[model samples]
Target: MALFGKALLIWLMILLLAIANGILRESVLLIVVVKTAAFIVSGLLLCLCIFIMTYLALPWFGRLPASHYWRIGALWLVLTLAFEFVLGAVIQGHSWAQLSEPYTFKDGNLWTLVLCVTFTSPYLAARLRFKQGSKFL
Candidate 1:
């Protein structure tokens, strides 16, 4: 639960940083509202797909306990990452190899780590809190 809270705080911090960056740049930024909306919508769809895929491919992955939520989530992320990369390339008609420029894979990796930490931490905290608390209704 503590980890979850920390994760959420981290996510919020990242968003705050983005907000500050937007202020400095004086341009449009994906603010918290937009980010939240996008996450809710996209996350629902992604979760459904990942849930289905996880159960379906569990046997093939050579594991008996692949039904675990976190494993499915990790796989979902990996799949989505690849899927988006392909979709973007196909739609724009530009392959990574062709439109290559100076890019830092490390930066992307770091941000992805931050996202995972933040999203999961808040979620874990909420889950733990729910387990301990009484009904509000």
Candidate 2:
């Protein structure tokens, strides 16, 4: 469907942003902070970026019921999870335990929190946009 196509496009953009965030964390943040702090900061930054991207892209979906936005969020969440596991474990050859380390919440890895934001951002963005009387909506 056109709606899913648009959501997929937006998710690809988010993926690029996520990759950039990881680069920044490794090259810059790690140099400036402890590893735990870097992970937390990077995760927070990614969440913020995801919400901003979702809000900006809201108009691209055209006018839709709130449920559609929720569905978009769900789609994004599923895509993100698939990408992480498939790319990290299958392509990158990481062990399952290694790939899932971030989900354990040890060492200040906020991946679970990031996932929560990714799963909810679309609906939250729609709510904010609607409250702001965005003409695009």
Candidate 3:
């Protein structure tokens, strides 16, 4: 597959994983009843998943343009933000204002962190020079 195609596939996989994480996070929270802890744990879990996914998947995308890192990262950021807004407004029935809160960190939402990690993961993976017998971290 081409670079953009590979990147799109990776993004879709991440989206599916994120959806599953949301469901699992909600279920766990219901049982544990600690919002803050649940949020932190789930966020970390998702971030770790993204890290592992990018580590394993980026090389599979094959040769890319010299600017692939920045291009893919920017594209992913735009797509993700749009997906979030559309999903929130259409599926979750959240108002535009309500959905906007997540982007505003002042409201105590850690979603911006999620966005940062997502936006940077591809670029980081593309920039790193993997070596034989090297650890992902």
Candidate 4:
């Protein structure tokens, strides 16, 4: 239960990072590049941020087994999808098609790649941390 709580907290932090990334995408990237390019760049940036954050937060998981790390990643993925679809459609008034557009890979949107990264980051981070024998871990 404690581990699950910690994972949820970490996920919330990741959500904040994502929100910041969205702001950057809107304010900076969109101005600097075409919409397609901005979407691609934003997705890649988010993936890098997620991986780095997961790496840094691994110590908080306290030397968990790899399976636990995988579970954490799965949890994050599910939470992200639910938030994107539910909140985007209900609160934001985006149509279902609009919400699903990114997944179509049209206009260079890299949402699918971003989701893959989100699902794998925790396990990948844990592997790297274990391989490096991080003192914090």
Candidate 3 lDDT over 16-118, as tens digits, reads 8888888988887546857766777777778877767876786686645547766877777898898988888988999878988767754234677888778
Model 3 Cα shift for residue 38 (angstroms) = 0.9
Model 4 residue 118 lDDT score: 88
Prediction 1 TM-score vs. true: 0.32
- In candidate 2, the residue pairs with backbone N, CA or C atoms under 3 Å apart (3 or more residues apart, or in different chains) clash, namely none
- The ten-residue window of minimal lDDT in model 2 covers 128-137
Better of 1 and 4 by TM-score: 4
What lDDT is obtained when candidate 1 is compared to the true structure?
A: 0.38
Please write out the lDDT profile of model 1 over residues 1-65, one tens digit for every residue.
34334323433443454345435323332343454443343334333332333333333333222
Give the number of colliding residue pairs in candidate 1: 3
Query: Superposing all C-alpha atoms, what RMSD in Å does each candidate have to the true structure?
Result: 13.6, 1.1, 3.2, 1.4
State which candidate has the highest lDDT.
2
- The residue pairs found clashing in candidate 3 are none
Model 2 score (lDDT): 0.93
Give the C-alpha miss distance for residue 32 in model 2, angstroms: 1.1
How would the candidate models be sorted by TM-score, starting from the highest?
2, 4, 3, 1
Candidate 4 local lDDT, 12-113, one digit each (tens): 998999999999999999999999999989999999999998888888878877788889999999999999988999899999889989899897788899
Best by TM-score: 2
Reference-based lDDT, residue 77, model 1: 47
By lDDT, the candidates rank as 2, 4, 3, 1
